[model samples]
Target: MVAEHSPLRVGIAGHIHLAPGSERPIADALRVELDRISDRPVHGVTCLAAGTDQIFARVVLATGGTYEVILPALDYRDTIVEPSRADFDELLARATRVIHTGYRHSDTAAYLAANRELLSRADRLVAVWDGIPGCHAASTDRTVDEARQRGIPTTVLWPAEARRADRRP
Candidate 1:
């Protein structure tokens, strides 16, 4: 149980490629789940990737909550697409704090380490996953598994109409 005086620290693990037009519904689902979690002030933790992480940060802000960001690597910003760079930069600036994983490259190892760091700081996790098992360590499934292993309460949001895009933004 969370201490009465502490704000809930919620983490996110989700897909980078989400279907077009899925944003509104997904945001709604997040809002609902966040409400169910607690009325205590929220402190979100995310990597601020495109799609889900971006949406989660916005929702946290909307609810008058604060959030921190975790960067996967020193050069992680370079991996963001040019079109989404502005959003990423904006969210990064809005974060109450930022933690870097100390990796030199935005590779699989860096991402896994980043997620681990995120999980370490979080009291619970929100997974915008499709319930599909992943083949690799970087997938949403793997992150959820890690959270469960740590005994972090996890809420999975997969709206009925939610779909994933064929490519990354």
Candidate 2:
């Protein structure tokens, strides 16, 4: 049971792409994964970009938890948040806190910095990863590695089926 004072803080790192038909499973996996770690009130933190970040925010709300959105830049309203504008707007409106980092525009550097901020504040890291390392600074792999280096417990939610699909001929 939680102490009424401290809540579990969870940060998320994951791919921006969710396969055409994999939303439900991924969401379930994330829920299960987080459940295994803390039964306390979960305070989720993520940069609300597009895919996993949005899902994380939704899951937090669904679980009766709260969330904080750390925007990489100030132009989020016009840039990345446009495709899922309605959902983004709703999440933003419901966030426990909303923070926009330095600079008047978004960029790779800003995103990496935002990721660092999320990691720095989280008590744990939940990686919705593909187990593949890519070029992105804020890739799930990098975030997982950073969490490990910082001694924060990390939970991975990439189901085996997702990996199998990735290896299809």
Candidate 3:
């Protein structure tokens, strides 16, 4: 259990398909939100997936905050595309702690389990969601809903200029 004076442990859930040029704005918004909690140190919790999760981890570290990683499955690294593999590996190495969900595959069940674990350990959740219902399982909206149900304080960040990129092949 965390002590009362421990750094605020903030969990992250966000979209992987970020628009071509939305990263900067979305990251700025995230920085703004995180800065609001400046009274205490920040400890981020993330799956380090490809888009917003990576961005959140970067912001946390860049701002002198630390973060932990939660892997959805043992083969989660294999699921990352070549382009994103470097970021994933880099962030994973810098994590203050790393946890695995004990699943062999990166599937919906594993993702849900990881999300559950993330929420269980976080004092708050930051969702970089667009407020749209997710079209598939293991989405930002689903995690946001779970966080809400668990009554974890949640913050949604969708900048006015932020958009989702087309899904990759």
The per-candidate count of clashes, in order, stands at: 0, 0, 0
Clashes of 2: 0
The residue pairs found clashing in candidate 1 are none
Better of 1 and 3 by lDDT: 1
Q: Per-prediction TM-score, please? A: 0.95, 0.88, 0.94
Whole-model lDDT per candidate: 0.92, 0.80, 0.91
Candidate 2 yields a Cα-based lDDT of 0.80
Deviation from truth (RMSD, Å), model 1: 1.6
Candidate No. with top lDDT: 1
Question: Would you list the clashing residue pairs of candidate 3?
Answer: none
Over the stretch 35-149, how does candidate 3's per-residue lDDT look in tens digits?
8865655999999999899999999998889999999999999999877899999999999999999999999999999999999989899999999998767888988888999
RMSD value for candidate 2: 3.2
Q: Cα lDDT of model 3 overall?
A: 0.91
Query: What is the lDDT for 138 in model 1?
Result: 85
Give stretches of model 3 more than 4 Å off.
Answer: 1-4
Looking at model 3, which ten-residue stretch has the lowest summed lDDT? 33-42
RMSD of each: 1.6, 3.2, 1.6
Model 3's C-alpha root-mean-square deviation from the true structure amounts to 1.6
